[model samples]
Target: MIEYVARSGPPEAMNCPAFICDTCRNQVVAEGIVTWATTIGRDGDRGPHQQTPVYVAHKGRCGRGLELWIEQHYPAADGWIDLWDDLEDFVCQLTHNLTNAFADDTEGTYHPHRLVHPKERR
Candidate 1:
């Protein structure tokens, strides 16, 4: 249901091999690419947090598709991060922890889209 697109700079240009997964006839329930960057804070910045942010997005397949995916995928108890932290850790977590979680059936199925608005009550 979920797949790894690629690892590269944002957008991956126009004709990159990463675009192979570009088309899905079944209609993507939800899909997005993860982009990471390292930025140096300005002199007046404030925080004890890391110097980067992780961003995850999901261009939902339809108006209600996103909600359906969340209901069927993500779980009630799982760690989450903001879209503004160094994505390195977030991507790594998804690649390893979340994927493993999916297999173990112990935690949520891990959806980049659900990460934004994790759950909704029926």
Candidate 2:
């Protein structure tokens, strides 16, 4: 099971809420976490403001527990065409997308994490 712990930054900064997983209970900082930022429109006088949301998973026996959790939660379709045969690849891709979303200046939306089914790309 996954447990969630809320985190916050200084009040001065517009830091969004961050979540920590307690299932695995690891000391690593942001080891298995996803953080994204988006802009919210303000009043006509004020410009849009940025909002960030962070998610972190607890450390499990192995570092790949997050991958396993995702797989279990979102099972692959039968005969799916997976770009990667190992869980590490999935984890890498997820982290890469998350990083990109966090750094994205215009679009801060997170890319969906999913496997391509057979012939689905065409």
- The digit string of per-residue lDDT tens for model 1 on 12-118 reads 63432221112232323224533322212325434232221222333434323433333343322322211232224445766686456565765554222211322
Candidates in order: C-alpha RMSD to true structure? 15.2, 14.5
Model 2, C-alpha of 52: deviation from truth (Å): 18
Count of backbone clashes for each model?
6, 0
Residue 1 of model 1: what lDDT? 23
Which residue pairs clash in candidate 1? 52-85, 52-86, 53-84, 53-85, 53-86, 54-85
Off by over 4 Å in 2: 1-18, 25-30, 35-55, 58-63, 78-122
lDDT of 2 by residue, 1-122 (tens): 12344446665545333333434554334444432222233233232333322224443443345445434433344221111123234357767877665556575543333333223333
Name model 1 segments beyond 4 Å from true.
1-83, 97-99, 103-122
What's model 1's lDDT at 60? 38
Per-model lDDT: 0.33, 0.38
